[model samples]
Target chain A: MDMIKIIKPGLLTTIQDNGRIGFQRYGIPVAGAMDDFAFRVANILVGNDEHEAVLEATFMGPIIEIGFDGFIAITGANMSPKLNEKNIHMWRSIEVHKGDQLSLSGAIEGLRTYIAFGGGIGVPEIMKSKSTYVRGSLGGYNGRKLMEGDEIPIDASKSKAKVGRYISPGYIPRYNNNNVVRVVLGPQDDHFSPEAIETFLNSEYKITAEADRMGYRLEGPKLTHVKGPDIISDGIVSGSVQVPGHGSPIVMMADRQTTGGYTKIATVISPDLPIMAQMGPGDTVRFKKVSVEESQNILFEYEEIISNIKYRVENSFIIQETDKLYNITIKKL
Target chain B: MYEKARFLPAGDKSLIIEFGDSISPEINKKIRDMYLAIEKSGLDGIIEMVPTYRSILVSYNPLNIIYEDLCHKLRELEDNLNDSGSEPAKVVEIPTIYGGDYGPDIEFVAQHNDLSVNEVIEIHSSRDYLIYMLGFTPGFPYLGGMSEKIETPRLKTPRTKIPAGSVGIAGKQTGIYPIDSPGGWQLIGRTPVKLFDPFAEPPVLLNPGDYVRFVPIDEKEYKYILKQVEENKFTVNIALLDK
Candidate 1:
C-alpha cells in the first residue's frame, strides 16, 4: 500500500469526504469538507470520485513525503505548493515519484485547501463516510487531525491516464476579501422585527475570529427581535443563519449540532456555501435576500455546469487516447 | 383536540412542520405522529426526519424531489396521521447516584431549593421526565418535566469540561450529559448508564418521545453498575409506556 508521511502537519489538516448522511437522527453531526466545491474539483482533477476523501488543510498546509508513485491534486486556496522546492500549479494533477517531497505554505487567498490523491485516502469508513468528526472522536484517521510523524495511507489504485490533468480556466473559483452571499429568509423570520430583517440584509458583517468548521460567528449590526430569539429546539441545517439574544448571526457549517434553540433568520444557498467557507476571520460579508425558487434555480445551474465540465474532461481524455493509438499504428506501418 | 400544523421552510432542501407554539406533551405527540406518518409514507429522496419539542424537520434532496411536490405529499400524509399507528413511548429507568464526589454541585442545588440533599434527590427521582429531543452533543437528551421546586439556574460560567452521565438542572430542564463536554447546567447527580456508545447499533440510549425515570442508588451500587456496564452486562430497564 502507498503511504504519505507527514513531516510537518500544518495548522489543522483532516481527512474529509462529501459528508456523513442519515446519522443526524442519532445526534451525530454530518462533518465533511468545509469547501465542498474545492473538494470535488480536486478529486475530479486526479481522476477520483467526487465523494472521495481528501485532506483539508486550514490556513496552512502540510509537508508530505510520498512513499510510492501516484498522482495528487491540490485545490481551493493557493497555498504555494512546492514539489522538491519547486513551485507547482493549483487546480491540476501532478505525478509524484517514490521519495518525492510535497510541501505547502500559508494560504494566499482563501481559508481552506484540499489535497486529493488519485485513488482517495485509504481510511476506514465509519457510518459510510471518511469525513472526520473531531468532536465525536469517531471516523477518519482515529478521529483527529494529522500530526507530525503520522503515516497517511493512500489507496494503491491508480488512474491509467497520465497525470497533469487540469480543470478548465472558466471553472476555477476566485476568492476575495469581500464576499456577497445570497440567502433565503426564514424558518423564524417572524421572530425578528422588520427593521431587524432589513438590518440583516443591508448591513455588512465581519467574520469573527471564532469561526471554525462548526459555525461562523459574524459580528455586525444588532438585530432587534420582537419576541425573544429563543425557539423550541429544532433541527438545524448547514448554512442556517441563527441569531441568538446577542443579535449577531451565526452561519452553521458542516460540523453543526443536530439541533439548536436560536431562531434562524435565513439560510445561505448551497451554491454560495463554498464562498462562505473560503472566507477568513477578517473577511467582510454582505447578505442579499432571495426567494426559495431562486436558490433552487442557482443550485440547478451550478450542477449543470459541473456536469458539462465532466463531459468535456471525459471527451478530451478519449481524444488523447485515440491520438496515442494512431501514433502507434503509423510507427508500425 | 388536534392543533393546526404550520409548514415553514427551513432551507431550500428542508421544511419544518411546527405543531404548536409551546412545548407540551400534546405538541410532542403530534411531532412524533407526523414523523411516523412520513416515514411510513415511503417518500423517496427524504433524507431524514428529526423530531423536536413541537416540530418535525423533514430534510430531502432537492435534485430528487422538489419542495412543492414534497410539501403536497407531506400534507396528504398529515391528514392521515391519526391512523399512522405511531408507536408508544418507551420508559427507560436510569440508575443514578446523587451527591458526594459524583455530583459536585449537589450542595448548591439543595441550598438553592431550601431543601436537604435527600429531599432534592427524592423530588428529582419521583417523576418521570419526557425526552423532548437529543442535541447539543451526541445522545444528549433535552428532557422536560422537572418540578419547579428543583429549578435552578445555569452556572454563571460554564465549566470547561463536564463528565459524561452527570445529571444536571437548568431552569425547568433536567438532563444527562451523553458525552464529556462543556456545559453550564447545575449538576445534581450522576448516572452510571452510558447514554451514548458509538459501538452500539443505535448509538443513543434514549430517543425523542421517550420517558426517563431516575432510580436513586448508593455509591456501592453505582460502582457495581458501572463495572457491569463496562463489561457490557448491564441492561437499561425499559418498558412500554401506557398510551
Candidate 2:
C-alpha cells in the first residue's frame, strides 16, 4: 500500500537484488547489484532480507516523494542525500513520513549507490530475481531504469528495529581515486607471455569511462599475448580479467555474458570486488596476484566480520534495555 | 575420443575444465558430456555450469564448498564419466527467409564470397551446423561448421542494431542473433523462430551440442510462421540425431 513517486530519476536508477542465479546456462546474464557489499549492508540496516531488491543509482541519485511512513537506508556511494531540504548521512537507516521529499546529488566518493526500503521494493521477480538486465529487457521495473514520474511500490511491512542504526566504523569501506585490487592468476594465464603477466600485475591501469555493469574496460599497459588472445570460446565468470586482441583487459562484472572468446589472464578475488565496483572513470587500479588459498581466506575473514556484526548489535541493544528497566524499578521502589 | 582435461581456476568461486584447445565436434561433445556428468552427480554448492566450445565453467558458492574439495569431486566425476550413455544430440531445423528487407546484408555476403545469393543460401543450409555454445545474448547460438565457400569477413563498422533471429556469417563462423543487438556479422537470412523468449520455460531454444539446419522459406511462409510463433503454436522441428 506504500509507494514513492519519482520527481526526478537521476542518471540510471534500477532495482537490483543478489542476482539471477541458475540461468547462465541459457545465456541469461546474472544481473545484480554492482556493489554487493553496499547492497547487503543497506538491506541489513533497514531490517530487510539481505537479498532484497534495492534501488541502485549510478553517479547521480533520484528525487522521490514518499506517500507513507517507512524505514530506508542508503549505502555504497556518498551522494549527499537530503530529506526535505535537510542533509542525511550514508551507511545508516533513516525514517521518512508521508509527503517527505528525498533527493540526492552527484556521488562524491564512489560510482554506484544503493537505497533499500524496510520490506524491499515490490517488483515482480523474473527468473527468481529482481535484478535488471537492461540489454535483454528482463527483470526489474519493466526491465529498464527508473524514469521521471514513475511510481515505485514498496512492501507495506513495517520494521521493528529503530532507525538511525549505523554500520560500525571498522566495517566501513574506504573509497578513493586509486585502488590496488587483488587477483588470482587465471583460467587462461598460460596464453599470455610471462612479461605480459608481469605487466598486468605491476602496472597501474585507469578505469575508462566505458565501465558499466557489463564490464570494466581498463586502459593500461598493452599485455602482449604469446599466442593470439583469441581462445576457443569459453565460459566467463564475473571478475574474470579477459584480454582481447587489442591487449586491453576487460574485467567482467555482474551483467557479463556467460561465455566469451578472449583469454582471461586472471580473476579478481570475491572480497575485492567491492573495491572494483566503487571505482569511477579515471580511477587508477593496480593488480596484486594472490594464491587461491589466500583469496579464499580473505573471503572467509570478510564473511566472519559480517556475521559478527548482528550478534554485537543485539548484545548492545539488550544491555541498554536492561539498564532502562533497572532505573524504572528503582524509581518505583 | 575422451581427452585429458586440465582444471584452471576461473576465480576463487569458479573453475574452468579445459577439455581441449580447439573448436571441434569432438571437443564440444566432451564439453556436453562433462556438463551432464557433473549435473547427474548432484554436486552440492554448484551454482551453474556453462558449456562452451572446449571447456565447462563451474561456478560455486565458497561458503558451502571449498575450492579444493570441488576440484577433487569434479576430477573424480570426469574420470568416471560415461560418454556412451549420454543423450544423442538433437537436430533443430530453423525456417529462414533469405535475401529481402529482413536480410539487408545478403548481397554483401554473397558478393564477398564470389557467389550468387541463391548459391550462398544452398551452401549455408546444406550441412547441419553444430551449436558450439550459447552466449553474447540470451539464446544466441554460437554455431560452427559453416561451409568454407560462404566465408565472409565481418563488416568494418558493426551495425547499430541487428534484428533478432538474423542468421549471420562472420569469417568462418555463423550464428543467430537471439536478441536485437549491435553486431558485425554479415546477415544472410532471417529466421522467424523466437530463439529467445523470457516467458518460455527454457528461454533458450537451442543448447550446446545440438545441431541446427537452416530451411529456406518465402516471404509468405515467413509471415505465416511468424504468426504461428506469436500464437505459441509453432514448435521447432527437432529430431534425435543418429550416432
Per-model DockQ: 0.69, 0.77
Per-model C-alpha lDDT, please?
0.87, 0.87
What docking grade applies to model 1?
Answer: medium
In model 1, the runs with Cα more than 4 Å from the true position are A158-162, A318-333
The TM-scores, one per candidate, come to 0.94, 0.93
**Per-model B-chain TM-score:** 0.95, 0.95
Q: After superposition, how far is residue A253 of candidate 2 from its true place, in Å?
A: 1.7
Q: What is the lDDT of residue A151 in candidate 1?
A: 94
